[model samples]
Target: MTAVVQAEGLTKYYGRRRGLEDLTLDIQPGEIFGYLGPNGAGKTTTIRLLLDVIRPTRGRVQVLGGDPRDPAVRARIGYLPGELALEGHERARDYLRFLGRVRGGVPASRIEELAERFEADLSVQMGKLSKGNKQKVGLIQAFMHEPEFLILDEPTGGLDPLVQHEFLAMLREVRRSGRTVLMSSHVLAEVESVSDRVGIVRGGRLVAVENVAALREKAVRRMELHFDAPVPAADFEGLAGVRDVRVEGAGVRCTIDGRPDALIKAAARHTVVHMVSAEPDLEEIFLTYYSDEEQHSARQESA
Candidate 1:
């Protein structure tokens, strides 16, 4: 199947500053792909290129099997921009109504349905709405069309916890219908929960793409154990998939990658008084890229 979104050597620049640099990626149809990065890492720039809001400086982009600039192709896609801007004096409902009409006379019922689903109060003025409410309006507009492909950037930026959870459930519903979603977020836990696969971008380049399950497999689970007495050093030695062991008085800590069975078995051999294990840090993969970049820059400066 053709990818929902495809780009080759995608690049963007704002005069002297590089917004994106020679990025290439593909998002499979019906997959919820998460795009993750920190501020100014070109997440928004990539989204704009996909939506044809701005042309790339080099390389090609295809969305929904056609050029992103084609009006017919855009109709089949829904996009929520990273920065949402609405002028003063317009009620939220009226604004969504205008968008609905622009998108080929979409039914008002769809708009109302989304408003209720998001728990958005549409009577409020656009300028007066709180940041969270404004974000809700943006989300409603994006989902109201019910397009085949949905691309959302920093979608939960201003949402409260409760609303954020509701939004995630709606995304799951979207996926259940076999539609595609590309969600860009910096929040690891949120993205990890909903995404089938994730692409980590740093310094305007794609670093890694992995399925959620595979990522978890490589994740390092931290465990700390307190024994009634100091355990023998040989007891924990040669444990499979365990590393970075540090043992203090009556306590031991280690990072276990892959399965935790070996580590658990090793700990069980001792007189265990207390034990704690933390879920793997999903963001560690992204941090690896940052660290590599820093080291490379340091080498260049030293030279």
Candidate 2:
């Protein structure tokens, strides 16, 4: 299938400062591609380049199989910037109406529906809306058109838990309809919950891109088993992928890398009464890419 979004050697520089470097990636249709990074890590820069909000200092990008500068391509994308600027006296409804007219008419009903889902008060002036409310309005505008691709930057920022859940549900609906999403966020839980694949960016460079399942496979899990009887340490000592093994009385403890198939089979040798496993948090997995050495290693591996 043709890529919904593609970038080759994509780099951006601001004077002597780096924005992004050598970012080559492809986002497939109907996939939620989570762009993960901290502040100043170039997530916003990448989004801007994709949208043609700013021209790249080098390399090229294609959005929806065409140049993002093309009006037709731009029309097919819905974007919400990280730092939304709603400095105006116009009511929320009025602002949306004006945007709808410019976008060649988004139905009023659609706008109203999105507003209701986000619990945004359309009657409130744009300048008067609280931070969370402003974010709601931003979300409404982005989803109101129901574009083919959504570029959302820190989409769930300032949202209450319930609304965040609602927004995630909406994203699922978007994917169900065969739409694509490029969601950039530093929040790990949100991305982990919804993204099919994630690209980790650090120091203005792409470190790694992995399927969510693939990432989980790399996670280290700590497991403890309480057996009905003392199991011989010899059983688990040499098992593949099991590390840091400790045997005490009728208990066995170890960290398992990837699948616990070998460990499980080994433990079944004895009567297992109970088991406790602690999965590594996604944040812990993400931090592995942030180290300079690890980033270099990842880039080399990818190459």
Candidate 3:
């Protein structure tokens, strides 16, 4: 199957400063590809490059099997930018109606369906709507036409927990229909929940791309346990895959790499009162991969 989005040596720069450098990636069709990165890490830069909003300093990209600059190709795409600007006195519904017409005539019923689903009050003027409400409008416009591909930047920002859940459901529905979505988000849970695969970007470079399940298997987890009675720190410090062991008073804290079976078994020796395990997130995953890369480089140098 042809990739829905492809980039080769995609690099961008602003004067002498680098925006994104040598980003090579393929987003397969009918899948939700999550783009993960911290701020100033080039997630938005890559999106703009794909949308042809700004020309790349060097490199090439294709969206939907054709050049993104092609109007016909662009028409098949739905994009929701991170910084959405809504102004003027036009009612939200009227603004959507206009956008629908621009995107080749989306039915009023379709618009209404989305509005109802998001519980968005479209009767209000665009300028008067709250941030969350404006985001709802942005989402409605992006999905109203039902394009073949969608590129969303920080798609769930400003949404309540319930609305965010509903939006993720909508993404699953889109996938079921064989459409594709590329979502760039800072929320790791959002990405981990729906993405089939995730691409990690760091410092303007494409660092690692891995299957979500595989990444989860090796993710770093920080665990804290509070015991009714203080336990010896030596028990946890020697456990495999556990590090940064610190025992203070009746609580023990440590970082565990990959599985925690060994730590759990060791901790069973003492009476456990309270235990909190921090699930690995994008930053943790990136740090793990980055550390691995550094170790490999050091080994090569020693050789």
Candidate 4:
């Protein structure tokens, strides 16, 4: 299948500084791709490059099967910028309607439906809306047209927890319709549940890309097991990906990294009355890639 977004050796420079470097990637169709990174880690720069707002120094890029500068391709894309600027005294509803017209017209009911989902009051003037409300307006415009591809940056910012939840659910529905999304955010929890695969970018370089299910296998999870009777620490120790074992009376606590098969089998040897497996530290997993990359880069420079 043809990729929705493809880039080879994608690089961007700002004067003497590097905004992005030697990056190559592909975003598949019918999937939510989470671009994971810290601030200034080239996430926004990559987005801008794809949008053709800033030209790359050297590289090949294709968006929606054609150049991003193609008018037809641009017409098929929906974007919500990281720093959405809403100015003027225009009513939020009016602003969205104008954009809808610019997009060749979107249904009035669609606009209202998005507003209600995000609990946005469209009657208020754009200038008077708070940051969160402005973001809601931005989101509404991005989704109101139902473009073929959606590129969102920090979409959950300034959104309340409930609204964030609603936004994520909406993303799933978008994917369900066989569309594509490239969502960039530092908040892992916000996208973890919806993202099909994630690309880790650090310091302007693409570190790694993995399916969310595969990432789960590699994540560090705090695990605890309760047995009806006491178990031996030796039973859990020395198991692959199992460490920090502490078996006290009927309680067993340990840390598991990567696959938990070893630990699970060990616990199965005993009568596990109860078990508690905390959510994996996905952010830490991403950071490990950053750390390894920095170390390797440093070593290469020294060599």
lDDT of 3 by residue, 48-132 (tens): 9999998999988988999999988989999999999999999999999998898889999999999999999999999999999
Q: Model 1, range 102-168, lDDT digits (tens) per residue? A: 8887798888888888889999999999899989998998898898999999999999998898999
Tell me the whole-model lDDT of each prediction, alpha carbons only. 0.88, 0.91, 0.90, 0.91
Q: What CA RMSD would you report for each candidate?
A: 2.6, 2.9, 4.6, 1.9
Cα displacement (angstroms), candidate 3, residue 138, comes to 0.7
lDDT of 2 at 88: 81
Clashes of 4: 0
TM-score of each: 0.88, 0.93, 0.79, 0.93
lDDT of 4: 0.91
Clashing pairs in 3: none
Model 3 alpha-carbon miss at residue 167, Å: 0.7
The residue-by-residue lDDT of candidate 2 on 1-303, one tens digit each, is 789989999999999899999989999999999999888999999999999999999999999999999999999899998999997889999999989888889999999999889888999999899999999999998988889999999999999998998999999999999999999998788798899999988889988898998888878999999998887888889899999999998999999899999999988879999999897677887776667557677799999
Q: lDDT rank, highest first?
A: 2, 4, 3, 1
lDDT computed for candidate 2: 0.91
Cα error, candidate 2, residue 84 (Å): 0.5
Across 110-193, the per-residue lDDT of candidate 4 in tens digits comes to 999999999999999898999999999999999999998999999999999899888988998999899999999987777788
